[model samples]
Every structure is written in structure tokens, then in C-alpha cells.
Target chain A: MIALDYSQFLTFEPQHHWRIGIAIYLFLGGLGASMGFIAALYKHIFKKDDPSMFAWSTLLGVLLVNFGGIFLILDMFVWESFLHGHITEIFKVLLAFFGAAVFNGNFHPWIQWGANFIALFSLFGTLWALSQADKAAILNKLGFLVKIANLLKPLQSVWGWGTIIFGLAVAAYTGFLLSVAPAIPAWSHPLLPVLFVISALSTATAWYMLWTYFAKGKDEETQKVREHVGHQVEWADIALIGLEILAIGAYFNYLYYAYAGGKYVFHQMLSDMGFVIGFLLVGLLIPWILEFIAAKKHIRILVPLAAILVLFGGFLLRYYILHYGIYTYPWPS
Target chain B: MQEQQNKQLPNWVFVIDLNTCVGCNACMAACAQENQTPYWNEKWRTKVEQAEVGKGDNIGRIFFPRLCMHCQNTPCYYACPTGATYKTPEGVVMVNQDLCIGCEACVTACPYDARYRYDYEDVEHNKQLFGEEFSIHQLPHIDKCTFCYHRITKGLEPACVSTCPTDCRMWGDLNDPNDPVAEIVRSGRAKPLAVHLGTDPKVFYVGLDTLPAPAKEEAE
Candidate 1:
């Protein structure tokens, strides 16, 4: 309903020196990266057996999802210029699949390690870029690293910065991203980032567990590997949930502050009116409940569902933050 | 006019006198009118109404006309990914539309929600509003108040300062001790918005008694 207020509105200046197109472009890039992971994960966990399916599927999903949004946002006639978007999209798909196969077995350990390193770098680089966006000097410095592997050394440096660094980079950026526009009072809280990081950690752990469960085979060594992976997954999930509780508590504290200041509009929306019900129902409670059920019965099916729900809820959390914040703070035209 | 023009024009500043000012929203309205700002539905600039110190049975209001504070060390300038927003040598906080990626980094970095996205028009209004081939980049990126830089560059006071019927606003320079701004600071009559924000706001307030408490101010 609220989306109607800002659906396809253009905020660009006709004769201005610059364009708003870049935002659309960057959004697409980010979307590609995120959707890539989603596609890869879904294909790997759900639709296994294409041999090269995992890589191709994930890369294609990421590019298409991200590019699709871009085209729609820009009102580009995709039918007219299908090749423009499709060429790069298809190339990346094939490349991703080929790379995955080449790096599949232990025989290509160095290449596998390199690929993993690149993936890790991309992950942490995104987190760092989000964090660095807060500071001019740091962001400028980080902006210089254009390649994936080049980002790894800096990412390694970030590892020593501890959970707080990762937490601040990933979490605070989430809040900053949501809150900066001011139109979304519901998304304006400082605590949203913390919640985001907790959600991320939870999703990551759940995915790891899902992967291990599916990868298990009828052998002692394989079982041992699966067991270890399972332990890591469970521990990560517990830690993520614990951190989420802390973030939720902080959000309440922020609300109290806002309420006392007579800016209770967002507080009322998030807490009293059941707007955040989905967060509690799907994001928080559902995965928690499913996880508990799985723990008691060892039902492997429930594990994937729990992981999927938790991840879906994480995305929903971001969506709500964006939309609700916009709802609360319309452009004071 | 020639002499007035030749004499180095005192760099204009905005001094908000908190003591006599009532939070009536008059200045804010006048500001929007003078600037032809979009609308409240699209606020380019805004007045932050703060709850001032209250007496036993009486509550007071402080009207802080908040625009881009145009700080010397603007955080938004630094956080911008595309180098879209930056400060000029004359200390105006401005955004370069072409360079802006619209990632909204500068928008987010600012504690003040001063930055906003200007995106593609909705499908229904697309052709009616903008004609065909409506590019998103054709829209504005992050839009904010620029202290009427166009007018200032042409040796005119900002619209908001000129339009304040109550004379609640004053413009001068921080560098010139003879300026009202310098005098006020020297006399310790000047204050700021959220001093603890480490933002080091250049927009100073005089007679700031009507502003809300810091705790309340921070939340807004």
C-alpha cells in the first residue's frame, strides 16, 4: 500500500551535472552478489545432481535477479535490448559453472583454495565496503582495491578486528543504510544493524549445516566430516540467536528513547500495531521453533526449512526496514 | 551599490536566537516558500521542533530550522562512494549529481536525514510526467538544501535569512570578529545542534534556551 507513494518516482535533475542511474547500477551489482549466493545455495541444497548445476544456477540467479530489478527500475525495454543484459548474465553463468568444476576435487587444491579465498574476500569486502561507507578516509582507501583477490589481504586484516569489527561493519551499515533516508521512521533506528548481523550469522550457520547434511555419505570418514560440520552449524546458530536477542533488546531501548522524545510514531508502528509481527513470527520464532523440533526428532527435512525460513526472514527484515522507513518519512516535497 | 559591492562582502551566516523565538513554524514556512522547495511530502529542508526546558506548569518549544548544517568537516562528504557530495573551498556542502552512484552512503552517513533519493517515476505517471524514455539517472540522486548557493554566489543572502519576517535569523561570518556570529561566540551566546555528535556544526544558535534537551534532540 505504502509502496504506491514512491513506486516509480524519478528524483533526477534533467540538466544536472550527474545522474541517479548509478544507484540503480550499484543496487543491481549488490543484488547480483546476493542472488548469486541464494541461487547457488538453493541449487546445491534443493536441486542437486546437475553436476555443474550449482555454480551455473547460482550465478545465473544472481545476475538475472539483480539485473531484472535494474531493468524494471530504469524502465529499460528489456525485449528491445535483451542481449545487453543477457550476454554478461549468460557468460557469468557458464564461467561460474566451469570454475566450480575445475576446483571441485582435491587434486586442484590450490585452485579450490584460491576460489574459496576469492569468495571469502568478496563476502568480507562487501561487509567492509558497507562499514567503510561511514568514514571518508577509510572508504576512499578501500575504493582503490578493484579486483577480488586484491581485496583478500585487506579482508585478512579485518579478521583480526574481531566480531566487533565484523559486527560494526555488517550490522551498523545495515542500520545506517536503513536509517539514512529519513522517510522510513520505522527503519531509522540505530539498532537495525545489530539485528541484521545476528540474522546473517544465523543464516550462515544454518546453510553450513544444511550443506553438511546433504553432503553426508555412508563412510566413516564422511560421517566424521558431516558430524564436525553439524557441530559447527549448531554452535553458530546458537550464537546467532543469542546475539539477535541482544539486538532486539537494544531496539526496545531505542524505542523508549524515541517515545520519551515524543517521536513515538515508529515505536508504535514496530511494537504496538503488529507491523513487526512477521519478524517475530517468521524471522525469530519460526526458525527457532523448527530448530527445536529438528533437535528433538533429528528430522533432516526440518533443518533445511528452518534455515530457509531464517534466511527469508532476514531478507524480510531488510525489506520492512526500507519500506516502513519510507512510509514514515515521505519526501517533504 | 558599487561601494557596497567593492567592500569585501561579509561572509553570510545564520544565527538562530533561541530566547525570544517561539516555535511557531513561521520561519520554516517562509523558508519553503522562498526556496520553492518541493513539498512536505518531499521535504528539501525542515525545521526541527524541540521541546525546550519546561517550568512547573508550562512547557516551551524550540524551533531549530535544520538544513544541511554545511559543516566544515561534513561526514557526508567523506562517506559518499562516488564522490558525489563534497565541500567547496568557500565551505558549502554540495553534491555532484553526475558522479553520484545513488548508493545513498552520504545520505546514511549524515546523522541528519538531509540526503534523499530521486528515482524513476511510477509507471502510471511515467509518460504524463516525464515523456517516454524516462531514465532513472535523469532523476536527481541525493537532494539536500545548499544554503541557496546560487543566490549566495550572486552576492545575495540566502532566501531563508532574507524571508524571516521576525528577524529571528542573522547572517554573518565566523572568521570576522566584527561579525555578529563572531561576537556572539566571543560573548558565549552561541550554541550548536547536538554538540556531542562530534559533527562540529558550523551553524551556531544564539539564545538557544528554547531548544529541547540533548537526550530528546539526539533521538530526532
Candidate 2:
């Protein structure tokens, strides 16, 4: 049987739709993990009297994101019954069980530990995929691994310096993935990864706030913990707003340069991308504004909605970057 | 002094004049034969593409002869696991048949979709005809255009260049100012594939009228 060009199946073309799908995938992955991290961290930091909601919510978010990988089957061209070798076997089957634990809301220690391990592994898997494309020229498979290492050898120290920073920042890694692809004007900023890290934190904080606010039938100490944690989340939202502004401004600056050079980049950005209107304005900008207002007024109700919008917008941002970076303009005259 | 040092090192380059190429698949045929590559398999180290842009009767089509660009900083090299891919001292981006574990890392690393790994039967057929020891179960390695490194090492022009019924293909040291290939590039008539990617490709197209857009959407 002829091997189907797997590349075609992966992208599922016409450009725009591919972008949206990738955005959704990244969004699910990032949002889930971020939500989990913030919930756990806040409970740990604040030393809340309540049993940690961090463990449960974090698990929920992570499992939901890993569940998104089910869509990968829709793309496999061969659809052959052939067993995957160890190279492709990096995506372990155990991830499913860990994901299940999150949704089940188990407070068991073993479950939380297993879920955390899987979440961390899945994050590395995503990073490994991105690192797969770091080379400058991609011809011939000669001493390929060695050649790749030669290229990366110099960057090893740099990678080492930033590993913990990257870990703490969480989904900020997704931003670095886009930044490496210089082709996309919107995603090619030095600050893109930094912005992603902040968003990850924001998503984490928001999940914690929601979990805490909803917590009831608890002791007085637990109730006090819930309200205190909610206040901390409110502050995080403020920081997210600042980061979002910087990311947007830098991206637009890149667009200006790309447009001014008569690269026809602006046309693609406006016409092709639904993010500017759908994600940026409605999802991110408006929600951010409302959250700012709500923060000042100490209005907790609007904060969740704002968090929902911010998270939605973040996914859209990732979608456009991944998709648009891959899309090419028709060649010059 | 730098120019003299540059002359001592082999700066690999392929220059294709779009005007003379007839899209006859002569270079493709020659490359496969010389490399002992399997036909009807996805193992063409060099392939000919008929590329055109613009609309209507005014459209101009050019024969695009493509191989690995042998970039100064190659992306595919790093993606490999068994260390099968690397550049030779002769500056050709090449594969070591002995070392290649055929992991398909370079295949994904390539944005151009140039690399293809053939199965054991195909590899055996190619190796058998050359009177070399070969196997069927485990295929040798990923195959691509070596710029005919074997012939070039023996001080011969590539089979593709020599077999071209039309003298459209040019191969030489691109680093040298005195070389015709360098002169052509300095004259601004030659263009590299995906210059925006910053691969600094050695293969340059002369008389290219249009950019060949990737028919397949995926980058690799």
C-alpha cells in the first residue's frame, strides 16, 4: 500500500481551519495545566485551612487537556492496525488513568502524585515536539542526531539557565514554540513566551478562585481560606492584564514592520484570522477591561466570566500563531 | 587571506538555469541511476518539478530541479537520532549508510518535505545492482540527493549535470568569487529556496521566474 503523505493529513489544509484546530489543542492543553498549577500553588502558599482544592481542580484541567489528544486519531492517514514502536510510544497509556482521577475528584494522595507526574510528562512531550524543529536546514538524514547536537551544544547552557524558569512559567513554553518560527509576525516576539507564562499563571489562579468560591458545607476555617484565596486570584488577574497588553503591543509592532516592508502580511493578519475580532476584542480585551473594573469594585461575580474570556482568548492567540506561522503568502512578482 | 582560506575548503553549490531545462526528468533519472536509487519508490534524491505562477495564457512554467540545499546550519541534521545525517568536508549534506538507523527524524525536520526513507526491498535492489552486500529486513537509511558526492570526490561532475541533454545545471564552489556560480549569485540572478528561513542554502536557482509554493501545506 502507498504511504499517504502524513504531512497533508497533519495540517488538513486551506490554512485557516488548521490554525483554529491547533489553537484549540494548545488552549486545552495549556488551560488545563495552568488551572491545575495555580490551584495547587495558591493552597500551598496561603496555607489555607481547607483541604486543598488545588489537587482536584489541577487534575481536572490536566486530564481534560490530555483528552484533547484523542483528536490526533482523526489525522492519522494510515489508520493502520500496526502497533506504534517505542519512538512514537512516548505518549504513555497511563496518562488516561491520571486524567480520569482529575475528573473523579479523588482526594487520595497516590492519585494526586500520579496526576502531577503525568501532567509534567505531558508538558515535556509538548516541548519535545517543538524542539524537534529547531534546526536551520533540514535536508538529508546523515549523522543527523550528531549534527543536531552540534547546533544545540552552544545553546545547552542557555537552556539550562532557563529550565526552572520555564517550569515555573508553565505554558509559557507554548509561546517559545511560536517565537522560534520567525515566519509568523504575530508570534515572533522575544516576550511571547513571557506573556504565555503569565497567562498560564492567570489560568491557574482563576481555576483556584472558582473552586474556592464554590466550596461550601465546610468548616469556618475552610470558608475563610476560600475567601482569602479568592482575593489572591483577583490580584493575579491584574498582573495578567499588564502582560496581555505588552504581548499585544509587541505583536502589533512586528505587524507594522512586516506591513511597512510591503510583505502583504497585514492582509493575511486581518482577513484570515478570526482572533482579532473573536478572540482579541471579545474574548481578551473586553474581559480584561471588565475584570479590571470588577477588581476595583471587589465584585467577585464578574471575575469568573472574565477568566473564562481570558482563557478563551489565550487559546485563540495560540491558534492564530501556530496556524498563521505555517501559512504562506502567494509568491512575489 | 580569507578568500584564500575559502578556496581551500569545498563550498558546495548547485546552480540551475531555468531557461534551458525542458522538464524532461533527465537530471532526476541520472541522479537515481548514479546513486543506485530505487525508482517508483519515494527515494528520488533529486526530483524535477514543473512550477509556474500567475494566471491565464500569460503563465510561464519553469522546470524546478530540487535536492537538499546543504544549508550551512541544517535543521534536519539535528532531528536525527542515529547520527545518520551530516555534511561532508566536501560540503554536501550527506547520509552514512552504515550508521543510519532510519529513525525518520530528518524527515520531519525538513520544511521542504525533501527527505524520504525507502523500505528494505528497495534498498536491497539498489545495493545488489552495485554488487554490494545488502539486506532486506532492516533498511539501510534515509536517502536524498548527495550532489553525487561519490563522483565529485573522484573529480567528476555530478551524474545529473553530465547527463543533462540541456546544459541547464551548474555545480561548483559557490564560496569563490572567481567561480561562475558565485558570479551568478553576486549578479543577483540566483535565488535560494525559502530565504526567509535563514538556512543559507548552497543550491541556488538561476532564471527562476516564480517561487514554487509548497503543494503540501505541512512545513515538513
Count the clashes in each prediction.
42, 16
Best by TM-score: 2
What does candidate 2's lDDT look like per residue over A1-333, in tens digits? 112221121111122222444456556656665664554344334444333353345435656566643432222211111232332222222232344335534333222333344456444323322232232123113365445545654554343223223235436545543443333345455666676766666666666656665665246766676777777777777677677777767766666675332234445656664867876786667887877888798776887787777767776677666555533321221
Chain A TM-scores, all candidates? 0.49, 0.62
For residues A1-333, write the lDDT of model 1, one tens digit per residue. 001111122121111111233223323323333333432333234432221222232334334333533432232222222344444433333343235424434322222232333344344434433332322222334454424324443553353232223223422333444443222334546666556656655665665656566665346654664565565566557667767867866776765666322144444446633436676677777787777777667776888788777766665555444433322211112
What local lDDT does model 1 show for residue A293?
71
Query: Model 1: how far is A74 from its true place, Å?
Result: 6.6
Q: Give the DockQ (2 decimals) of all models.
A: 0.07, 0.08
- TM-score of predicted structure 2, chain A: 0.62
Specify the poorest-scoring 10-residue window by lDDT in model 2 chain B.
B211-220
**CA deviation > 4 Å runs, candidate 1:** A1-194, A208-232, A250-276, A320-333, B1-12, B18-36, B39-64, B113-139, B210-220
Off by over 4 Å in 2: A1-25, A36-51, A57-166, A182-191, A238-242, A259-265, A289-303, A327-333, B1-10, B28-64, B78-85, B94-145, B148-159, B173-197, B207-220
* Cα misplacement distance, residue A42 of candidate 1 (Å): 18
